[model samples]
Target: MTNRFFNFNRAAPDARSDVSFTRRLVSDCVVTVGVLALFGLIAWILPAIDAPVGPEGIPSTVSTDPSNLPYYALRSVFRMAIALFISLIFTFVYGLAAARSRRLGKILIPLLDILQSVPILGFLSATVTIWLALFPGSMMGVEAASIFAIFTSQAWNMTFAFYRSLQSEPKELDEAVRNLRLSHWQRFWVLDVPNSMIPLLWNMMMSVGGGWFFLTASEMISVNNRTYALPGIGSYVEAAAAEQQPDKIGWAILTMVIVVVAIDILVWKPLTAWAEKFRITQSESTEPKRSAVLTLIRQSHIDDLLARILRPLGQFLDWITRPLGRTGSKWGAKPSRRRAGDIVFAAIIGILVIAGTAELMISIARTTGLAELGTAFGLGSITFLRVALLTALCSIVWVPVGAIIGMNPKVSRLIQPLVQVLASFPANFIFPFVVMVFVLWNISINWGSILLMALGTQWYILFNVIAGASAIPDDLVEMTRNFHITGWMKWKTLILPAVFGSWVTGGITAAGGAWNASIVSEIVSYGHHTLVAKGLGSYIAEATAHAEGMKTIIGVTVMAIFVVAVNYLFWNPLERLAARRFNIA
Candidate 1:
């Protein structure tokens, strides 16, 4: 009799048989050749582009012609790809460090919270000069700066997602891994990563959208009378807006929409479907999502080739870490000594925090007087109100719509990719249209800024709600139907509670993103006319543009403090309530 627990299915044909091997080799060769050809094409065209080289060897000018749209889009996508790769690395290292050490997590978690709330504009203002100086005359410095800005936008939320997932790992699985005596490295790959896959993937998708939201600001680097435009869709849109050409703006928007949709179809959807298998639940998921691309890949000879390639590498890693696993306990200090070490670490952190706070206060005191401080606080209040009101409005609209879409699998499959594309649309690209309308209609900057902020932020709520709603168990749905639960009763009891955790998570991210978007949304400019709103975002933007280090730092520091305070007093408590009281077991 076959052992059900450890069956190998020996009846299957050998994957390394002569015919199978030949097919796998051919498939891999084709893939390799296609990738090389694509790279070659990019290399051939890059030098021919008409961007002007500066005395310092950097590209100082950007081409705005419609003909350059494809090249610009490709450059933007490449930067985003590099930033995403860097974000992933940061997420793993930082997230794992925080998760593994309770002592470290106390400082790391709150630090990450503050970092997330810090605006992309703040990063650009602080780091762009440094990056430019680092690279001297090369455009590589500008590229690095732009990529780093995008990284700030994308990395924090992913790190949070990974940390939360790791912290909430199933206790039974935790015990199982410990009993098996897996090394830290082994546990990370076999347990932590797999368990966190679904949430991490969803957060990663949102991070990509967040990166796009800041693309224009990052790529069109303008500060202190100097402007450096890296050839990208962001700069394309900015140039169109500057020229006041609606047709070119429309083209840019269209091109962006196409790229976002393609990425969703080719990358995110398949990854989401694959991640479903990793969900840790007591009852097996019923009729989980299916991806046509995933199915095609799985059935192809290329799959066999990948398996053969990865298998040896995976084995080699395990072998390399085997000794560490065996000798881990021998390397650790005794309990008393370890406790002393933790105390010393905590003391060091405390001293650093106090010193940093003191220095910041001294800097602000020297830079500006009471009037400037009062102005910053008052402007911060305006931005806060906008974020709060817009967040509430977005929740009201998207929560129900997301619930309806998520309840039906067919509808979800059709609409999820569309939502992703919408989320990933650079909200700044539509700023020209908004500015044009506001200018013609005589609308206030206050309301116009709110609308732009909402446009960039609402999709976070929508996508997260969909993910939560989709995870609702079939058995639970059947039970609700069997009980004839309907109307408000059904929503109050079933749907609302089911998606509460996700909604809170989405709200937190959306709120942070809105605060970041304020730097652009609060200060709208079209051609020669500019509308500046009374808010901290505008303050930061103005300060950044003038390269006023003290004012920029003060504005950013005040905004960060406000955001951190709100998160602690409001969002943090709400998240905890949702997790404890509303989450489905």
Candidate 2:
């Protein structure tokens, strides 16, 4: 029976064989139908549960009842899944485009840096009205805006991961590919993607965590005097906070924890285990990460059955792409044609930048004065200081903890999922509880806001540190033990250096996230009580709420400029230094 399940045999069949085949076919069909039915039910229920659209296209009502938590959690998960799928596609294309062309790479890489630095709140504030206008008097516009917000949260890091992987492809592998004359499509699927899979998976996990961190803000968006609460965990939490119901907030937190654990068990763990094969270093380690769910799926007859069913479609794709693979000409263009294309692209970009700058300047001049400019600059400096201090604090705490956890494979396997769940838990869900404590204790809003930003942003540092430390070779670890390396010496000579590259990556991401989190964290509210911190985030939030277009633009632009400048002067140099000094290869 095991052989029958594992082996694909086509030969003259006896009656017993025929009977077994028929039974297998029936089993496969039943499993497929059951899976489809489950997904179909979810799809059907989501629309039914969504609040009716109002005249202004916002949802008329959103339930905060604990009983509705399951449905709301499902809606949020579904939206995140959709956004993740879109992010994956974009990552592939954008990463490839930037990696393959020098001219495009120069342009695209910096563009990604700027895009990632642009606060999520900025994207929401700028695009929500446009999206609403596009799908007037319908929930579709709001849904689109929410999904896009999530996508912005998730996509940039994934793209950077893939692009870095491609650019850092081993010289020998690059030579082999050139010698083999692999087609562009073939190279991507067979070489680039598989080679990049490990880091890409890790970054993808981080991106999902980020999506969840900001999920509440995305779902319960307030922009330009308009508030739309989508039926999701985010909106549920928002409603709970608004009602000042600690019990409901607790329920939402519990529901989110359960949802996150379920996703890890069913999706991420299986994918992580499966991606082990794609690791570029073929050296066998002492112990590999294991997943019971993945093992069970692999051993199941359904796995073989699905492979058999999908084999024909896979074959058809190969057949259609065969001609392209055979012709190397498809991968190249004439020098003259390439030069012309570059010129045209540059011209278009230049025109757009000039027009955008002119329009922005005109708006700023018309609506913003010297006083407003000074206020924005002052508020921005306050936010910048908070980001810097918080990022440093996170690095100091998590780097050592992450290094310790990562160096122990068994402990890491046990604890990583829990950490990820914590990382993904929306900080906003606990705002009511936070408000209660602060109100009772009379704590400063500024300090409380800093703590909130830390909670939301520190995971980037922790997870990246873990990834880096986990990648350290067994040989290096054994050597360290042989030398009796311990304590601060061990950290300095072995662990810290090993994880430096990852630390830099994490710090950059964490700082960017901190900047983004400010818009929500700097202003805390529960029912009639509100605590406003003095920062750029509060400035932008206030501007957005009042529909002060020029103020919002000025705040967003100033923040973006600061972020981009820091990246260029500080993070970029540190990244290069880490790559040069600490990278194992």
Candidate 3:
């Protein structure tokens, strides 16, 4: 009887095991189906992009109906995703190259500054023709132009963050790479990239928000009185605003909130949880971070199967990189040979830059005169005053607030998604209301520009501060608490010094953002009343709107000059100070 009972139990257990296997198979199949559906949807989108342009040859048409919101959201998200991928690639190549060698950095760094300082519409005005030429009579051209504009807004922020993080690399890590016989290429991929992961992740989020801020301008723009629009959330907002539909505007904001939350849950949370492992600590964290998505993937058979399929590709990359990592005999071996090579490289770059400058100057002289140049300079000076004061004001307000938010992990996690949504909110949507207020009160755009610029740029400082403060080691916080360090001394000794490097980074980018925001902020339009500020931003805006390429170039050049001067006179020295005074690693 006992043997028979045992046999029955064993058979029942076997049946349950079989049922579990069947469920696992079904789960894997579901994952497979979901992935295929995603690809199918992408395939659907490709045809829409490649379709021939309508008679207008710009926007075609965008529907503002609530039912169409999902499609528009998807389109905008897709463009954003593509731009982000391009920006990531650009950040890696440009930031690494600048950080790798001093001689190269002298040229690349300033070029990056100039590129970032150029306003969004300036880029649109300059690059739109080229994109149209590349894809003549196709919507692809308009789409490409939009993506390029978004890339310009995003790529710079990430590049700066990556470059700054590389600059702060620990000496010990460098020594280890050398001791491990890792060459320059190997060190970059294996050591440098990993070390900068935290900063890169945070800055990438900031870059996305920055791109979203300009999405409206990218999607719907007017050049030389020719209107171009696209099918996206940005275009939807533009259309609704034109019709003065407050309900539609409210709906758009609600949709934007949904998208932001969805992205946070589906993308950022998993990445953030995974990045926790990269934090520099002497021991494993006592409380491990968790992500449902990461956990699900870990348990999924599909992940392992895909990894196996991609193993060969991974190995090929590793193999290809190994040889490139080798140092040339002349590099870092002899001082004279290295100096000679550097001089030759510098000379070649200088010749190219001079040639470009000569051509550009000739064109500028033909299309514009010395008077135009003088006018631009005067306008730039005014904008410069506003940008400087506004940046200072933002820093003063956000620094301590960011520090407080950062130091509290519980609060940081709770509020970070909300911050992302807010930062990503398009200031263009708020312009009408602001302009209405100005019109009612008979206020000038010159004074109102301050609020607009601050609205757009202040988040840069806040985000950077939170990133810096969150990185403060737990032991340090505990030690300060043990010593009863509080009030001004605590801030002076612990908080300020800890976040100094981040502040410098934030301040530089915030200043750049203000310069860019000035393009829209300096010029506002409501139903009938248009307020224009007497500044470089309005100068550039007018130049771009008229399709006066030479004038835009002049405006950009003057802006770059101001930015270069500010960096040299202020930011560079602060960067050095942070490195020497606070860079313990």
Candidate 4:
């Protein structure tokens, strides 16, 4: 009877096989075209990046026609893609170093705060000359500067998210790694990265928005009294605004929407779906993230074929990693050896700092004096106050809203694309209109700068908090239900502690971003009216405008000091507290 049953089952010729074969055939054709087109587009754009510069510098023409937007969008996307890759590398190296070593963490975490607060414009202006010297006659120099500027805007948030995630590494995983006696490298690959993946992906998405926030500033380059507006959606929007062409601005908005939608579909959604497997929750989400594109790729015979082709390479990696996994208790460096390495690292860093300080002092002594130092610090204090207040206001407004939205998966899915479009739209494009309204209201530009900075800064808080709230474990939710927990009691016990780490991540980035946004926000121009706020941002901008190198350096240095001080006193302490509370296990 059992033999007959086996024979019957085998004879049925499973219907699922027919459907699978059909789906595979269809997906194979689709994936083939997609891959070809992607590579072809990349091949076409490489020349544009490396094009030789003439006496006029890299060729950049901004066209008003809507038809050209597709090309503009592609160029902008390419720059963003390169920046994101660079940022990921920076995150891994810098964030991992800080997370693994307490001594390095003290230095790097504060340094990261300062870097994120430094204005994009100031960094670009200061470094553009060096980049130009490196690739004197190629567009690649301009391209490199632009990409690096975007990297500055994107990298800090991801690095912070990663560092925090590592600190919050679930105790369960730590025990498992210890049980297996994994090497540092092995633990990094297998445990640390997997644990950080969800938060990192969420931060990566937010970082893309951060990149767009500075797109205009990065794409439009000014050097030696000559302005070069690169061919990108950012420059396109800038041109439209310059010409007072509201119609063109409308078209740019439409193009931006399309580009944002494509990114959400092609990139973030698929990755979000795939990362679900790495989720730390013991109880799986019934309504896990789903991606149509990933599903299609999974159905494709082409994907399977590629996997089969790469199987040997994957196995080779595993084979090599095995030696780095476990033998006994004899792994990692000795205390003396580690201390020796730290001393060498500190020596190298100290040398760099001394050299930079000597050069800065010499330059300032040659140009300005002690009076400018006081002026710069005073301006920095004003800006610091604005950033602090604005960050607090944004937190109050967005934290609960983000938490509510994130707790409901259906709501998050529905609202995610809308938020993406809103976040991806550069608020700088609408600055003139906002300024005009403020002018009409007889508002104080000094204080009103807070509102403008909030345009770009608030989204960081919202995005991070949503990720934190969404990550709350299903078992925790069940526990809350079982206890009939609600209202402030639920929040005090379950919600706040769970999301505190993410909130800190958001708060730090938001505060840093507020400082960065001040460069564009603290000074505004509308027709015949130019309003300037009394802040470090305006100090830097005015200095840059007049090509006052010493003043610019002083203003930037003061801003950096403010950032480092604030982080050391406030954000770093909060992060440590959150880390202590973050472990789910």
Cα RMSD (Å) per model? 4.5, 5.2, 7.2, 5.6
Cα-lDDT of candidate 4: 0.81
Q: Can you list the residue pairs that collide in candidate 1?
A: none
Residue-wise C-alpha lDDT for candidate 2, range 415-481, written one tens digit per residue = 8888878877777778778887888899998988999888888988887888777767677888889
In the range 414-463, model 3's lDDT, one tens digit per residue, is 77778777877776777777888898898888999999888888888888
- Backbone clash pairs for candidate 4 read none
Which lDDT tens digits does candidate 4 get at residues 410-457?
887888778767777788777767777888999999988998899888
lDDT of 1 by residue, 137-202 (tens): 666778889999999999987787787667666677878888777777668777788776766787
The global C-alpha lDDT for each of the candidates, from Candidate 1 onward, is 0.79, 0.79, 0.80, 0.81
Prediction-by-prediction clash tally: 0, 0, 1, 0
Global lDDT of model 1: 0.79
Clashing pairs in 2: none
**Model number with the top lDDT:** 4
Pairwise TM-score winner, candidates 1 and 4: 4
Give the poorly placed runs of model 4, Cα more than 4 Å off.
1-19, 59-61, 183-185, 301-363, 526-529
| Model 4 residue 279 lDDT score | 68
Summed over model 3, clashes come to 1
Off by over 4 Å in 2: 1-34, 49-57, 301-355, 478-490
